[model samples]
Target chain A: MRHTLRETWTGLRRNLTMTIAVIVTMWVSLSLFGAALLANQQVDLVKGKWYDKIEVSVFLCVPNVEGGQCTSGDGATQAQKDNIRKVLEANPQVQEVYYESKHEAYEEYQRVYRDSPVKDVLTESTIQDSFRVKLSDPQQYLGVVEQAKSLPGVQAVLDLHPVLDPLFMWLNALKWGTLGMSVLLLVAAALQIGNTIRMAAFSRRRELGIMRLVGASNAYILTPFLLESLVAGLIGGLLASGTLALGVYFIIIRKAATSITTIMWIGWHQAFLAMAAVLVVSILLSVLPAFAATRRYLKV
Target chain B: MITFDNVTKIYEGQAKPALRGVNVDIDKGEFVFLVGQSGSGKSTFIRLILREYRPTKGIIYVAGKDLSTLHSWKVPALRRQIGTVFQDFRLLPGKTVYENVAFALQVIGRPTREIKKVVPETLDLVGLSGKGKRMPDELSGGEQQRVAVARAFVNRPKILIADEPTGNLDPATSVGIMKLLDRINRTGTTVIMATHDSTIVDQMRRRVIELDAGAVVRDQREGVYGTA
Candidate 1:
């Protein structure tokens, strides 16, 4: 162990530029994964913050129907509308339902487009009434949806769960994509490490040969070099984690959070842990290359 | 003690063997020079001892281990008993002379205190005592070769394999390196050196194994470097 360390320290000292290059490469690889992690975390934070207030919009039918959603009992009958109102008011999941009559609907449409020319093309006679439902929480929509589907008077039900659905879906894709990119960068770092070790071993071929002749074990020959690689990788991981944490804290959390204070704040502890995880991963990936390069290219 | 019994080596895609029916015995504490021109079996002999290349048709024994069956796992163990120095020196360009010598001990997982004593002492033996911190490039060819020699002998190996130790040095420097090898031999370590340097061979008057076309044609005590 003492021998291995002395060798590792001396190897590191001798190969300064190569050591720096390895560290930089590892840092960049880890940082890419870290950024993607932050992005996914942000998306998760947004979804968690907003999912509690998911709403459902239930459109009501006209007295004599004209928007072409009236075929095959498709539009709500009077009985169906009455049943929906009862369900919304009594269901444990429902917080409240504000019924929009045709008049109220027309007024909202006008209010929304008061300055637009499109408002002149529509009147209250042509507008449809609807029930605007807000749930106690978004997750309750599953139970509420099952009940709403069987209700009579509802013409259509639109749950706000679909809004947060895209958030999770996109987050999933981004996390995996970032993971793939990190793997590619890790491969690049390994190859670079291999090349550097090869050159190093090649240059010291005589020393290695001599050592072998003297009955020095292979373990003695490779241990120091392996340790050298581990040291380089660890240092690189630390640098990468540091850089990523700083970027997340300043760029994503503090600066972006300033404009999005209504959303959520990412704490320092979680960020620190994430970077630490990245460091561990980078260090693990580097060991094999150190072994392979020395064994194959630098073999005496 | 080592023996090469009718050993032959055929590399892939080569029609002819690198070594053919080569047979010889090198006893313990003996100093022998393997002499041949380039492309002769000089390198093949050294490699066989190191187990870098195994014999194709015969058994070669080093320290009682049949090298033909030596596995990768057993390699390091085998290497610990023999020290080899190559013609090119093969010094780590980034390392100082001290570190270069220390690396030999370090790789085997030696203790720090042991390496501390061993490294500097080895350097001093090679006449680089005060030049320990200088990098490989900072040293001359003779000094670099000496470092390689010191590394080979640091473990107190049973055998020292020097394949053209003075290949890159001047005549005087070559004499200095040869004398160093002689001193090492006097300490009871068997030495096997491969060289084409006729001047050194003639001067040493040691046992010389002359190779021609991958086969030994002459083995003599107090022999001169014979023609290929």
Candidate 2:
């Protein structure tokens, strides 16, 4: 064991430049991998926050609007409005149905268009009463919209999917792009580790030959090379973890979370999970390639 | 003791065999010399004993164990009982003479107390007692070869194989290495050496096995280098 340690130290020091190159490559690649994982988690968090609040707006018939369900034509009566509410409440997919009176809708319009010239043209008389329906599963919004469209005095059912789909598509693209880049770099890091092992084995060919002649077992001859790569991988893993922590603290928590207060951001728990993944990947990347390279070079 | 029974070795991609249907035996406590020109299979004979190459045709027995049937994992155990020295003094360049000698014992998992005791004794036997602190580069070619001999014999292996141990040394230096091998053989350790130095072989007057064209041309007790 002492001999193994001494030999490993000597091998690492002998190939100091290659060892450092391996560590640096592992660090950069693992950092990117961790970042990709965090990006995926952040996208999931954003989806959860937004999807929970998604609503389908069911607009009622207005007085002068020519609509199929508005045969009475004086506007939807209280009886028709109550009937629509009962039907929505009875649907299993609907979580909650909120009734917005004409006055409430007019107030919402005035606040939303406070700076627009259209606010002067819109009034309580022009505004239509609507029911904002929240569903247990946002994916079932189409069913709710179909059911409400067939109800009495309902003019139109508007789903939020079209308004929100483009934003989610952009987020999904960013997540996968980061993940793809990380995978490519990880492959490069594994190759670099293999090169480093091959060079170290070549440099110590004399020592290895002597060991083999002296009846050193295969494990005894291979342990030092494995340990050298293991040490480099450990250093790289630690550096990647540090990079992840700093990135999450500075970019996600400190900047993005503060600026975008409505969206939920990932916490340290998720960051730690990503860091663990980085460490596992780094160790596997370094040790497996090193083993293969050493085995190839150790052949007498 | 080592015995080769009708052993034939044909290397890959080669029409000619390196060794063919050769039969020889050297009992324990005997000093044997293998003499041949390059590619006459002297090296192949040495490699077969070391278990580095298996015979394509017949079986070999070393210390009464069948080498052909020896498990691959047990090769190290087989090698541990035999020490080897090569043409090049294959010492760790960064290590001292004492560490170089101790490395053999260390690889075989000998204890520190045992290594400390055995290394100096073997170095002394090889006439390198005071030079233990010196590095391989700091020593003369003869002294470096002495270090290699010390490492080979330090583990007290039953058999010692030397392939041109004195190939690079002057005659006077070569005689010194031969005397060291003679002393090692006197300790009842089987010593097999391959060399082209006829002067030393003629002077040593030990058992000689000569090979020509992958076949044994002569095997004589106390033989001279040439046909006599």
Native contacts kept, each candidate = 0.63, 0.68
Task: Tell me the TM-score that candidate 1 gets on chain A alone.
Answer: 0.60
Best by TM-score: 2
- Model 1 spans > 4 angstroms off: A1-25, A38-158, A166-187, A198-232, A239-273, B85-151, B164-187, B195-208, B219-228
Q: How close is candidate 2 to the true structure, as a TM-score?
A: 0.79
DockQ of 1: 0.30
- What fraction of the real A-B contacts shows up in model 1? 0.63
For DockQ, the strongest prediction is 2
The best candidate in terms of lDDT: 2
TM-score of each: 0.63, 0.79
Candidate 2 residue pairs in backbone clash: none
What is candidate 2's lDDT per residue for A1-300, written digit by digit as tens? Answer: 998999889888988988888888888878888887887776665554324465788889988876757765677778989999999999999999888888987776665444334667867997888888889988778899899998879888888676757866877787677778878877887788788888877877787888788888989988898999999988998999999999988988789867976545676878998999999988888789888888788864
